[model samples]
Target: LTFNIGERPTFRRFSTPLNQKNLTPFSRHRDDTLNDEIQSIRSLLDRASSGGDRDRASALDRAEKKLRAAQGTRKSYKMETRLVPDPRQKQMFENKLKRLSEQLSQCANDMKALRGNQQRGELFVGARGDQTNVRGEMSGDEAGNMMINEMNDIQDKTKSSIMNTKNMVSASKQVGEATMEELLRQREQIRNIDDEVMRVDDNLNRADKLIQKLWQADGHGQVHTVLRVRQHAAARGRHHLHRDDEE
Candidate 1:
């Protein structure tokens, strides 16, 4: 119906399958990268639990070591030893407690010593332009003053450390006392539990005897129907006798 003039400047056509084919390898490569990333994430998740456990274990170990050092004991006592009810073990614990007291006393002495010799030659320094201090012989005094300053610094640090140690010792003693109290409470609880078990067993045994007696009465149901009937009959006979006596 129209003359075939010229081709249009632009044309629309459906995308060829070859274009999609070109993207297949790239898509596969991207999927592999994503898969690798997912695997890394999964690996971290798998290891997270064990790593958390290891971290917890390390922290507990460090705390144990520090507490032991505070108590002046290099020996690592097992957690079970605290539960063993041995008289000799009790004596050992007492001895260790005594040692903590002794160590505290030693720290006190160190503190005293540091305080007594605090800044012996503080603020004493060199003088210049003098006969005895000619050619600056008193220059040596500057270094001496520095040495004194350093000593004072060291003494101050030692005092602080001693106080900290004393505080730690006190805290350790408190912890020990608390631990002993808890142990005593646990022992009491265990005894109470044993008593409760015995009582339950006794009650169970009584219940068993009751059940056996009931079974002797009836096989289907553990009820003493025959004995109950006998009792009821005896009561009725007693009532009839009372009526006859009244008549």
Candidate 2:
């Protein structure tokens, strides 16, 4: 997967190898499709009624299928790439998947709660009908109390779902913060390395200059000694070594 930092992150269209004929073609639009399915499910959940159990169940099924497809696509993408993705991209993908999973869980919980309410409503209706025929079996007050109890149970579940969602959001936020901190730490390390390289370069330049100065001083000292020997030989009126040998 190609990660362009400047653009909005998107799952690009990728081609799989011919050897992997068994896998479905991963679409670039899969993310969009998954999001649409989730939104549809949410809408259905919102409009859920005692009588629309079938519709809710159907939406749930569709959502589950979409989630599975998304998961499969993720697996396929991982399998196709030889190179590991950038950490930031990987984290983004993981966070998105986590969010989708949480959404699915919430949808499931809502569906279950709605289903329970529908069942309780049916029971309440049946009990009332039976009470009309059977005397002193179940009072109207008892039926009302049963419904109130069911409502309270549903409320409790709803509260739990909300709390769970909040916790997940908080966790996701923490993970993102950690990732940013890690990136910042790595950047600092890189800057330190660059600074160290510059310092080493400066030291090397200074050492080179010192070596050049030493070499120049040694050459001048040798030349001065030779001049001194020549002057001494001239003062003593001595010939050169080669002229002495010829004589």
lDDT of 2 by residue, 1-247 (tens): 5667797766766585454443222322444555566677677667553224455446555655655565565454444332323455455545665676677667767767776665655577574563453322433466578678778988999999999999999999999999999999888866766665566566556655655665577776665665565456444433333343343
Q: Output the number of the TM-score-best candidate.
A: 2
Candidate 1, pairs of clashing residues: none
Q: Model 1: residues >4 Å from true position, as ranges? A: 1-138, 217-247
In lDDT terms, how accurate is model 2?
0.59
Q: Number of clashing residue pairs in every model?
A: 0, 0
TM-score of each: 0.31, 0.34
Compared with the true structure, all predictions reach lDDT values of 0.48, 0.59
Per-residue lDDT tens digits for candidate 1, residues 1-247, read: 2334595455556665334443434433433443343334334333422333333334334433433343333122222224335567545654544554454345435434432332222223222223243221223355466677778888999999999999999999999999999999888866766665566566556656666777776684535554465456556655654554454
Model 1 alpha-carbon miss at residue 26, Å: 97
